[model samples]
Target: MLPSQSNPNPWSESEPAEWSHYSDLETLIIEGAYSTKQPQAILDDYYIDFKQKRQISNIDSNKQRPIKRVQRKRDDKHLREERFMDLPVGTGRSFSGEYGWVSPFIIEVRRHLGLQPDQLPSKDPQLIPMLVEKAAQGIITEAIHIRKQREAEKLAEVLLEKKNKKMKEVWQCCAYLYTLESFLYKTINAAMRLIGDKDHEEVWRSKVGTLGPFCLLLWDDPYNTKVTIEKTLYRGANLKPEQIAAYEEMAKHKNEYRSFQAYTSCSRNRKKAE
Candidate 1:
């Protein structure tokens, strides 16, 4: 064999002597040459720590398994109170030969409160008193239920349904109340269009809690003499970024109405006057 075929860069005597100075130098050199793409010494230390931590964690998990299982089982068990309460009037097969038993009690309560089928409570001082009475009745019913008086079940069901329906009705009425307020204020605003009565607009602005002098942004200018205004229109202008996007969406329908051009002209005149 040629001399070139021999080991080109084999470890020399001095190199081996230098390596021998370190206790595990030979093992380090071998690992560095053929092991993972990490610093072998550091990696070995990390791996040892990782193995110890994993063993500890496995032991901890084994100890906690029964406790976790018990907790899960407890969560799965339904309460007896819930089972009985869930049987309210129309939910399933009528209990004690009655369907929608809540209707009678609801009617009685509504009659006593002097409310019609659609009539909601006025914004009067009596409203809070009525709600308090109803809540008191609910508490009394709960007490009766706790005593295991089966006869009180009918009354309880009725009261519950009435409470639910009353809540729904109150929400609906509040919506209409807001609409009424808007209509009244918007009407007042339209009347003050060219007369420069800032007080009317100020009243609305105050009610709505807006900063500085503000007025509803009119969609179709009611002050326009050229076109006959049909429906009074105003939109809240104190808008956030998200509301600005909504305004742009509604504005896309501007061309659909026949009075749009006349409305635009009137709006332009109002701005010019301002």
Candidate 2:
């Protein structure tokens, strides 16, 4: 690679704990060389996790479906339980019944996108168009899986038809952040809200914990590499003394890394950060 070209991170010899949730295929792609160009087969693998695909296959071959559990988000008591108390607990045999005996992940996607229980996106094609911009490809992949699992093969086909639609949106959102994050205040307020004792930790964990690492990884890679390389970054500015103190309370010494859960902001512009 040229000096100007990115020195892509090579596959790690030891697997990372962060990647434990990734399927074998996903791991292979990440753990191996970063291929800038994606092939069609790789793209196909991008949508549905291989393990989930295998589960569906096994269900077909044995004619005996194993009882499966959708991995629950941590600390679901605050947001999911309280906000989504109306989530139906029963199952249904058709695609039209999203509220029916569907996986919890499906319910989460619906809720995240502001859909009603038992409301199928099929009934409102405009709903997909409206959400396509904000929808992450990974979540859409889960939706596709449920659609397929329900014997509503056609809906899955439609969802997969333009797999990159949501992906492009995600890319754009990331790109927007790269230039300027007007949402910094919103993000800071969110961090401020997350600051607290174990109960608050549980609530935040249940709500946005799944996104925390990925968002951190995104923030780390590009801004550090593309924007702030060899440049100074600042924090503890514009923040109230209490907010900074809160961060100090939460900070922990993790090996060489000082890990803190919340209560600070980072910026390249020193004055702006302050």
Candidate 3:
């Protein structure tokens, strides 16, 4: 036959039980539910405040609550797993197999997070794992924005250079036209004065007197003329040698054998008419 159990309650027989003598019925009703087993004795022995105990219980419940795992994207995962040092500077993009601590970027992020210098984690990999996706997203967004801004600045600089080049070409062309016009005026005046002189035939015999204007028109000095124009027009420009030679040849062929005096007379008459 089995030994007779002394305890009346079946639960008390299987599980260990504790007894408390309550002074008042109100106290018993209030504390009875929580005073079961050995827990109440441990609480009492430690002199733990009821409110503090409740707070501890609350903390335990919070610990038990399920934490939602952040789902990382392929790119995000790569960024997180990769060494910050391997990421492209000023861009959030990651390179293949790049692993290292990007000290500057990490420092920047820590500053943004309001973390102090001493509070920075010893290891980059260890700290990165705890970073939420949102925070990482902010860092990436800032990096991308910086990259775009830099690109825009570079584009602006290129456009400005192009504009300056075009302006220089226009100025060179204007200067060449002015010089050509001045030469034409001087030649016309000399021809008009010499045409009526008794020494007109003699003047024509001397090539210097008759062809002086043509020589002046073909002046190709490095300091003040043809070479200067070439250098100015082609400065910092992309032009083939053949292209420059072809242009020069074309220029030399123009206005050949043209009657300068006759053209000048016509131009003056046209101006007077206007």
Instruction: Tell me, by lDDT, which candidate is best.
Output: 2
Q: Compared to the true structure, candidate 3 yields what TM-score?
A: 0.15
Can you give the TM-score per candidate against the true fold?
0.20, 0.27, 0.15
Ranking by TM-score: 2, 1, 3
Colliding pairs, model 1: 102-158
lDDT of 1 by residue, 1-274 (tens): 0011112222243332121111122223323433554422221111111222211122233321000001112211122122112111111111111213222223434455565654433323234334534533433343352442222232223233433344434334322222221122232233222121233334323322110001111111123326444644421122345535644665697653211110111122332222
User: Which tens-of-lDDT digit does each residue in 9-47 have in candidate 3?
Assistant: 423546554332221211222244345532321111121
Off by over 4 Å in 3: 1-184, 192-198, 204-274
Instruction: Please give the range of 10 consecutive residues that has the lowest summed lDDT in model 1.
Output: 63-72
Better of 1 and 3 by lDDT: 3
Error of 2 at 112 (Å): 15
lDDT of 3: 0.28
10 residues in a row with least lDDT, candidate 2? 89-98
What is the per-residue lDDT of model 2 for residues 1-274, given as tens digits with 9 covering 90 to 100?
Answer: 1001111322334543121233222323322323433321122222322333321233343321112213443342232222212222121110111222333333444566566865543344444444432333332333353332222122223334443444344334443332221222233234324433334445444533233322322222222223323656654323345545645554553323232233224556665433
